[model samples]
Target chain A: MDQDQKKETAIGSLFAQWTKSQADLWEDMIRMQFGMSDASEKSRKNPLHQTQKAYESGSKILGALISTLSEPENLESALKGMDSLPEFMMHITQQAYEGYLEFQKKIVEIAAKIGQHTEAYKFEGIDQNIFKVWRDIYEKEFRQYLNVPQLGLNRFHQERIARLIDTLNIFQASLNEFIYMFYIPIEKSGAVMQEKIEQLAEKGEIHDNFKEYYNMWIKTLEGHYMTLLKSPEYAEVMNNTINALVQYREAKQEVLYDILKEFPIPTNKDMDELYNDLYILKKKVSDLSRKLEESRGV
Target chain B: MSQTNIAVNLILKKLAETTGKAKIKVRKASEVLLSPLDTELSKTPYEVVYKEDRVGLKYYKPSEVKHKYPLLIVYALINRETMLDLQPGRSVVQTFLDSGLEVYMVDWGYPTRKDKYVTIDDHVNGYMDNIVDFIRKKHGLPQINLMGICMGGAFCVMYSALHPEKIKNLVTTVTPTNFDTDKGLLHVWMKYTDAFLMGESYGNMPGDLMNLGFLLLNPARLILDKYVGFFENMDDKDFVENFIRMEKWIFDSPDVPAATFHQFVTDCYRKNLLIQNKLELNGRRVDLKNITMPLLNFYGQYDHLVPPEACELLTKAVGSKDTEDICLKTGHIGIYVSSKCQREFGPKIIKWLKEREGEPKTDKSPETSRTPSGSKIRRETVKYVSPKKIIGKESKPASPDLKKAK
Candidate 1:
């Protein structure tokens, strides 16, 4: 055969191999979807079942393209199959928009609940309830997106970015909770001071000395803060906040390492290695010097 | 007059008075704030005699050296040693100097990333040991008076145990030897702290973060009330100057080396190993029973950082029979800075040291000597002895001028 004919033959075989692999993957996916449906009636009613159905439809289109490519004579059929690509993408986009809308609805519902609680002056429950609501929403609805499996050559980098984002969110949430806890003392102290002032007013003994009132309020605030700080709940929240911060910083450092790798700037990993070596060398020298001193009886 | 009218009048009168006072205060405050005030810390002149990496030795020589052995004061790495010499009147360094006693202090300079691997062992056995040896050589004495403040006290305790012959008199102020207590918020929090993770993450524990933790311990006082006090006393130049000085000192914190911090929090705070004498440095166990020298321990009664519970047990745990623990009625910083404590704390320490201050070594015949306890001791002239020889010895004070501390 001529060189051109040989090259064309080689390309045809490569395309056939690619088609076979894609066909096998689609077939396995279909079989898994059917198996899942058959295994549990409950799973068939799940949100993931809808995703499987969408995947099944996309798989049919892909199968058509694969067959047309393998047959080589069905070029027109492949072009016809390609026409469904935009529709398939639109279907996926619509699902995503609906999911986003659902998320927004949940957030608005929680926000409305918070507004109602605040309007009623239920200060005691407001902080706790708000923190719970936000934390629950993030963990249950949004955290999974950050934890989703990534793919391709940039999979690790993408995963690091996702983790960094996830950790940042977690850190902010914990920090907000901590700040709210800190504010509770102020709120409680204010209520207590107000009660004291009201009692003084009732007795017709309200003092003109503002310093005394300030002292009273400050002391009450301090007492409340002391109680709050000493509590196990406060300790737990503080620990969580600190841990989240550390995790976020670590994630950020990892991402920075990737970015810095392209630049001439030495990363923390490089410096740490150098530090370790220097530490060892210094320690060895110190030990030897000490040994020498001892041997010399100096 | 009607009740409403009387109330209105009263309110108006109070408001008028407050406004007048505030105007005067503001005018005075502005003048005071703008004035050049001496808020400088460590005002007592001292020369840097030795330096090792980031650490330095500050020597504050007296007009006349009254004591035979010079004192080596090791302040905590958490804060600057300038706290001792905050001001002329309140300066602990000055107090020691005025007593005609030679004073030497360790300035543990700021730790960078390179110092992350510097452990407690490096501190107690390495820097401290070298400093002690240098002093011993300088003075031609076998041992010197060793004093430690706060975390530095912990290091001193470890050093004294490891090299008993190198320390004549051991004094620990606001030192926490026993960490198995919930009296202090620090102890409680440290118990739950992931020290290893913190060390690994930050390389060195940042000082600002520690200060933040301290502020959180008493937010109403440290954060709010402190600034409130400053604002209220803004008109008083002395108060403002003193406040600024204190502010400078408090915030002038150095990062704790990561490995040292990790080991301290783990071995001392988490495990409570120091009191148990289970703590080890440089592969050698720090046995409290090895500290045979006279020990004077002081702790503040209201010290939230290092409570009496964290310090009082040290004297009882030590091998020294002449151990005294004085619980001063003050907070952590107040024990040194408070005017009331200035009278009691410095005088008491000087008196205690004087009582235990042995005679100077001379080339004359060996004479009989008396200890602070009024016991007669036979003098013996001897050459320099190795530290290892005196490590585990249970020797008592044979002579006041003896080279061996025991």
Candidate 2:
């Protein structure tokens, strides 16, 4: 009934409530995951069900520690319970790591199949699925880390840095794709030229003049390039590459602006504003001079 | 001998010859590259007569001026006007001068950061109008003959529409006024280009980037075959000089003013406003019907940048009764630089302008000049006369007989 005892009892009750809520939340998650009303016999055999059980046991151990700590005489027992915490966390982490490895293995298998299909010439363009996979993986897994809600006085600066890094990666990927598209024409032209030369050789029509071959190869390359460049696919990729480059440049300029704020040299933003103002002022003067000239009939 | 043995022997023989030729070519190329070569461009003697910010006006007065009105030429902002006077034998400016025509060309100097805000209106109405008026005042005339090249041609068209009284005859060469056609890769790509984003991000549309785009239009030829051809002909000194001169001109690009680039792409390329006469510059619509001057529109048949489709429609779109569209048998730069076109292109324009010279300015009233004035808009009538026919068996100077009926 004394103040210290009353405080210990209140703390004990709070810890007990927390432990019960945590257990209830785990049970609800397991049930929802299994689409079951309760943790039935069938559900208990599930790996997630085992995970729920482990969570419950961990919470129970924490509850025991809280109760033991509340009673000053059982402080040793509470410490012993705290010693088991690391082991419990290891078990949960191990399970999650195994799950991630399995997922990655399946993705790798799918990616390998796509690679095979691309080599088999199933698709017309540079294998975009590989790039798509990389982008999807980054977007789904790593992008969230950079996009995590930043806090503190330097949060804006931090976010800009993050954006710069993100845009740079995207721009580089798009550039790679664009370069690959360009390489396609050269590759096709070489292959086609080789085939043509072989056919000519077989027909015993091979010319001694190497210039003929050079001309044919170049013309073929130009034709291939024309077809590729005019395609909607190439246009789309070019636009995407340009957009990525622009975004990267803008993001980089923003970070540069922050860095250059302390320097004596003017940044593009500063110069742009000044240029815009000067442009307007000069235009007005030019217009006025023209009007004046017209009025004078000169 | 067996066929395989014969083929192997032939290959070996060809390889030996190629190696021998390459060695000689490399030595000759090194000598040519190291020697004091006359590879300079714009060799025609001219004086810078007027200056306005980054723009300059070059006056190339013929020894004897034949026409009553001086011909003012406006070159595109994309590249330096040095292209017109690339070399002694291949210079368009020289051809005009030889024909006793006084030439005034606009040298749009390299734009810096300050020039990023220069718009189409500034180019067409501001600088172009000022230059026209300056020429008119200097010559003591109400109007002067105006000619524009590439994007400059588009500017001339706009100027002629806005101020018809100042242009006695308007000539557009390799201009892309009707950008709606997808016959050229530039038109197709420009439709997808984010011009505003490009302008805002880079401040000015970088000349180097534009060159890269141009190279991509035909990488096989521009990037690959061009170098291969150079190496093959490295032993020829004349070829080397001409090639080097052209290389200098091709790469000597100037950054386009950002605002002008944006408006051109949006109004002309994407919206197809210039051809539709819906393009507005400085609150005034560039109504094609306002162009009442004798219009001579010339385009290259093989021009990949500005196809004949893009250039041929301007003559029909204009209000001028005396409009002619000449589709030269060449590419964009070829129309000006190619030896074959040097005979056909310049002479044809001179003849057309000569035919309309000294005529009274057509009244600008809507009812007066817009109607059929008996002068027909000639289309596909001028054939590419053989160089042998024009330059006769006696090796006479080549002159296109514009009066000859096909």
Candidate 3:
């Protein structure tokens, strides 16, 4: 490659690397924030009280799953040793609740930013004589809040969470009953049967009957989940999330440009005049853009 | 340059003569033509001061309309019903009131989310029922003289037919009934529309949308040429005022309830249910044969929205032997507000009603003699077509057999 081409390739690689690192950083941040580093800390309740109960329940199930994964051979041993349904239920509910809690935090953060910034920026050329256009948008969003069964989440989000919780609860109860009636009795009598059950648990695959019940619960939950995902509320959140990421990248790029473009930070007096002139320039440019658009029937 | 140009200029010259007479006549009648007492518009006759869902009627009773029997003006729901009583010298309400007729107009109010569920049945059966009941209670009368314009005329026809005993005499101007005619673009569009989807997507079909559809029907005239001509003559105050008033009325539209919109486009327009006598209002069959009262059906020879062919069917629909179809040489709105209408058409309505009611001694004997013929009414098959078709579209299908024809 020529010198210029080589430099371009290097810059492109650096950008790709930076983006990959950013994604990793986010995942790391989430894990640390949730205290997933250690077993004891992983099971602890989140301090965000609204999500605390849900988080605690989810983390506990996640803790059990992690324990099983670390020592797969012992899962068979554990299953054989297991006596009651309550323990299984406790784990399932915990994991489901934690996933929902994570979803909640992400949703609220995005929704709040959209709610604030949408007001800060006005649409460029709507006729002001048409009264209550802005007010109607505000009213619809306000009504959205009321329509939600719970505050902070959209209607579809709340419905999905409810379905998840419901399915987990039923699965937990039913599985416990199944284990108590069948598995415990077999495990108590024969070492060979206990070993077989332990082997199944270690593989992370239970008997066909257990799998059927679990799959049914998942299927029900998924039906509600897919519906929620397809909803306008979910689309808004997903769009806003992507937009936030893009805007953050743009702001970062602007910071780099500012560092490159300027000699140094300007004095306060200079900054005042600079901002004023910038604003005037922005207004003039906006007017010019509008005139162009109007001419083109845009 | 064009045939229309020569005809319009000649009409305008005749309009100027009528204007001169009107100015002189209005000056002499100013004292007697003062605003009506104890009416909502007494303070400001032009503005909408009162609106009510509770009372189930929007009474645009201009202080100017002061005849003996209050003229109940019904306008098409597709447009605001305010054109008849708009303002000052150009108003139909003012002309009627000046001629001594009390005016009560119906305003189909703006529909909201709650009103989105409203159907043709709710409007025709419920609200109309309440309005008639209220009027009856207020006036202590068994029947009221009714005037329906455009779709409102169609609604009045439905109401009158369903409850003939309640309508003393029926007057429908520019009302369309026979939709089978492929004469108007609007009829063609309505015939082919997917009303179900339109109703489902937009809970209330917007009047603005409907207006846009209408404006598209004759884009060269309505959208471009008319506006260009209007701007050219913008300096003339009288022309501008009348133009503005007409524009205001044309643009001011109410969103129709989804169910009503669906039924109107599908049942009436698409299926041609009303004219076929298969239309049902609130589970009750609407048979035009039930209408036996005095009927005066009028249509403009030049109305594009409701072609003359579309509107002339009313005279034959009713079992009323006393029906009169008055075909005028004007468009839809012109039949009410034009200077020609005042001098030529408005007087016709007053004269007909007076004859029907036997109010004038000279016309009383003829009307009295005609009362016996009403008893000879028969419920039978009849071919009904608006006189608009016979005069204009020569290729239109033969009129069905009249009850008396057989």
Candidate 4:
């Protein structure tokens, strides 16, 4: 295989593995939140048995999608297969809105239950007229405010969250298509491959193609590897990717911090922290593999 | 400067020579027909009629007057007062004279850097006081019949209010009283205007700049259309002269004394304190309600500069039970020189005054008494008759631009 194809295969495999690891960690947290585990025999007859069963099924589906990104050929095929994802996401977003309406109905039911159990006592501001006004306002408009119309981001706080997650899946599928559509063709064609590699390197990113190409080229011939190394592009790609990985980690941490602040779903936080630790391990392994591939002196 | 003078002299001489060609006997016929053509061309003969130190007022004696007491014409400090007596027949002063009224006008004179310190108090209390006193002394009259134009009208109104007993009758023409109005852009813009920066930058606001601002309020007509029309009608000498004369008067602006400008803009128009009868000059409160004298208040219906809303406010503010507000179908300047004003406005003012004064021939009153601040308490009484020709020596040509743009 050509250096470019090899690099593509390497990147595709690494990205898929990282995604699968993240998915696995999330699945583990979901099981833990529901007080279930592979070792628990009572899970079979538990009252919330469906929740544990659903988590397992969802994790498996997500894992399969992530694995498809691991191989160069599979990644290319997936990009072609998901060309209409952006349009699909739009349809999915509409369905999520309907789900949110149902979720709002459930919230009203819960609010009524809470009001039945809670006692109210007020002396200073208990105007009967103001109560009517507030009741009218609540029925008319205030409930709709919880949905962020500006971002068109679907809600996910209640059972409606499943529909929102489905929309996000489509969005991510489109983003993956965007990555493959650009990265695959450039890697397949060796003409000006170094230039494309350097460009991507300047962005501090290691695309699948560059990683595979460098590994394969180093293994083939010592003289060729030395010649390629003499070109500053090789060193530049490595430096840029390292910088990108650092930036990516920092950005991910920020996103986690923001999510924690807003949602504070402890189970999700625990899963996120677990994923981060695994990501560090995965990055260390990838770096060791790259060093071993280089030192072989192809 | 000498060349400008010579050019002006040539034009005036040419105009006179042309007048001589006609059978013009009376000053009225000569001035009416000739004055219109004097400022026709850009190169026409027009000059500053008078320029002197702090004292350039053209004082008149009772012996020189055709009527009993002198007619004190108070024009706004913003413009040259000579517009009232622009030329013989077209002149308002000439009309008063023809009707047997003695005329004496106060000239504030051109203010310079040294005069920038002068205030509203100085002009109303000091300069005006001295002019009235000089007339009273020269003619031995206790008070004079006072008529103020525009800002000069406001000054005269205040003067009459402080010393109502001295003014036999008061006539204010196109005088702004209620400055709070949307009819004129100037009043509204002035509420937030910073004259301090303007004065600091330009020393004194240039007359052209002030004029331009006024013209801009209606640019399509005042600034552009009028000038274009003037150029188009240049072939007609009469049209050309009137155009240049009007341009001259409009552009001949006096640098307003800084202090006076500050007070006028801040205290009067911006605050609308004058009409409220809450304004004070020096230490004395100017209460418009103090004016109980017979008043003839005139306004121009088409005066965009001073809307009737502003000019008519005087009727409501005054203490005079006999206040008459006449709305003329004319613009600001037309109220003074329009044919309508000549035939009706002038006659009406004289009749009103005559009625209030009780027919000058029937009643003989004593010298006007003075108030605490030396302001005359009542109109002075005297009897002086007209001669066929008590010729006023021709005034030197007022600078071509006496009425600066604003």
Give residue B274's error in model 2 in angstroms.
1.0
Name the 10 consecutive residues with the lowest summed lDDT in model 4 chain B: B388-397
Report every candidate's CA lDDT: 0.79, 0.77, 0.56, 0.57
Q: Which is better, 1 or 4, measured by lDDT?
A: 1
lDDT of 1 by residue, B1-406 (tens): 2232125567678989999999999999999999899888888999999999999999999998888889999999897898889888888888998888999999999999999989999999889999999999999999999999999999999999999999999999999999999878788788865635666688789888887888788777667766666677789888788778877887878999989988998899999999899998978999999989998788866677787899877877888887776766556776787776788778777877887875443333224444454332332233434432331111101111101100
Q: For model 4, state the Cα shift of residue A15 in Å.
A: 48
lDDT of 3 at A33: 68
Please give me the DockQ of candidate 3 compared with the native complex.
0.01
Per-candidate TM-scores read 0.79, 0.80, 0.47, 0.45
What's the TM-score of chain A alone for every prediction? 0.62, 0.61, 0.19, 0.25
Worst 10 residues of 1 chain B by lDDT: B397-406
* lDDT over C-alpha atoms for residue A177 of model 2: 79
Candidate 4 docking quality: incorrect, acceptable, medium or high? incorrect
Model 1, docking class? incorrect
After superposition on all C-alphas, the RMSD of every candidate to the true structure, in Å, is 16.0, 13.9, 30.2, 35.5
Best by TM-score: 2
DockQ rank, highest first?
A: 2, 1, 3, 4
| Residue lDDT tens for model 4, B40-148 | 2222112332323353455433233445656677888776776765554556665665566666777777775555556787677666665676667767877778888
